[model samples]
Target: MTARTDQAEITALVDRFFLALDTREFTPGWARAYLTDDARMDAPVGAKRGAEAVRTAETALLRFARTQHFASGVVTDAAFGTDDATASWNAYMVHVHHSPAADPLFVVGGRWEATLRRTPEGWRFSAMTVHVVWTRGEPPTAEPG
Candidate 1:
């Protein structure tokens, strides 16, 4: 990588990371597309590291029948250089449950901050944390399997 790499690459990486939640399923190496082998993911439910960390993270939303994650206002501190970079973004997520009962949806507004590093696969997140700023509706009552 050069002193300043292509910022667009980073932006696209951010996009794919969030979009994957919609259709991606849990599988071995599923996280290879976006996370390092030792990546850490901190969510409201909990935190973990290494492969399990990514495994739990990827499956966290499976309890919901459908989920949509939107990432906006992405800001990068070391966007183009440093081998390791920091990027943050605002996310508004809407989740729906399979139940036909009342209040089967929950909406969350949060900020996602991550540490990314260059890997042979590409730009992978070494660490990620979600800070909830606001919420509406009840979240999934069932834990992710």
Candidate 2:
């Protein structure tokens, strides 16, 4: 494929990754959309590798809480190699939870570092690591203080 095509594919894959999370579709089939067979993933809790392991970790996280990962300020850096290519993106994630109330309890903003490889299935994330920058809880009541 051409360099432009590869870059486009990488962008689409990253966009779909967030779409899957928003739709709460963490199934193996869906997870395969963004990850390779031996992908490595690292989060706040821990890290895991392989497709099955990544799926398991994603399932557990989705089950733990209702989350909406809003990725903004996305900037992609792509480098083309002979056969395979690598790309990285910097983004801010606004994590929201829906538990006690139908409101955002916490807004954890962070940066995501992803390493993507070109595959027959298109661009897939071979490794992903998230680094949290800051976390802030929901604002308190504004009645009388």
Candidate 3:
């Protein structure tokens, strides 16, 4: 594929990932669809390896009644290898909950860096690092009532 085509594909993959998360449909199948088997995700707390681990971490964040992830200003670099690429994007997100009453709990502005691979199934994230540059309000938690 041409460089332009590759970049488009990468961008789409990134968008799909965030959309899936926003919809809270992060099942194991969803993880396998978007990430490599041994993918690594480094977040504020730490890092998780493999699709299962990543799924678990994402699932925990579902404590919020609702969430949305939006990515913009995406930039992608395609390497010589057909399957290798890298991308960076800014993410604006909001987390909301309604356990007691509905309210917006947090506003997170973050950056994402990802290493991608074009697997037989299509492009998948090999590794991703998320840095929370700034956030307003405390992050929500799933504590026992």
Candidate 4:
């Protein structure tokens, strides 16, 4: 594939992850579209491995009434020659708590780094990590410990 095509695919994979979470999509094997079978994921709520990462993600998401995520400035260090690559981007997310809570919103901004490997299915994350740069509003009262 051409560089632009590779870049586009990598960027789309990154964007698709946020979209899937915002939509709360848990269709069977959906997580595999984004993560490898042995992926390591570390986020605010917890750390998870492989497809199990979706469980931690969904649990954290259920605490919020709604959630929105935006990813931008994606930069990829393409090593498609080796069928692997690394990418980083900035993210801004807003989580709205269930009504009746005193503080109903939690906002967080962070930088995310991901290692991707190309499998027969497509590009999937082998490892992902996020570094919190800032946050506003209070998080959900019932976050998993």
- Compared with the true structure, model 3 gives a TM-score of 0.89
Lowest summed lDDT over 10 consecutive residues: which window, candidate 4? 136-145
Q: Per-residue error at 11 for model 4, in Å?
A: 0.5
| Highest lDDT against the true fold, candidate | 4
- Per-residue lDDT of candidate 4, residues 1-145 (tens digit): 6667767888999999999999997888888888998999898777899767878878888888889999999988777467788999999999997865667789999999999988997788899998999999987766543
lDDT of each: 0.81, 0.66, 0.81, 0.87
Query: On lDDT, who's better, 2 or 4?
Result: 4
lDDT tens digits, residues 10-37, model 3? 8998898888887877644678878888
C-alpha lDDT (0 to 100) for residue 5 of candidate 3: 88
- Give the TM-score of each candidate: 0.89, 0.75, 0.89, 0.92
**For each candidate, C-alpha RMSD in Å?**
2.0, 6.4, 2.1, 1.9
Best by TM-score: 4
Task: Estimate the lDDT of model 3.
Answer: 0.81
For candidate 2, the lDDT comes to 0.66
- Please identify which of the two predictions, 3 or 4, would achieve the higher TM-score against the true structure: 4
Per-residue lDDT of candidate 1, residues 16-127 (tens digit): 9888787766666777898888889899979999888876766678878899999898877664535788888999999888777677788899999999897776778899
Alpha-carbon runs more than 4 Å astray in model 1: 1-6, 79-81
Number of colliding residue pairs in each model: 0, 0, 0, 0
Model 2 clashing residue pairs (backbone): none
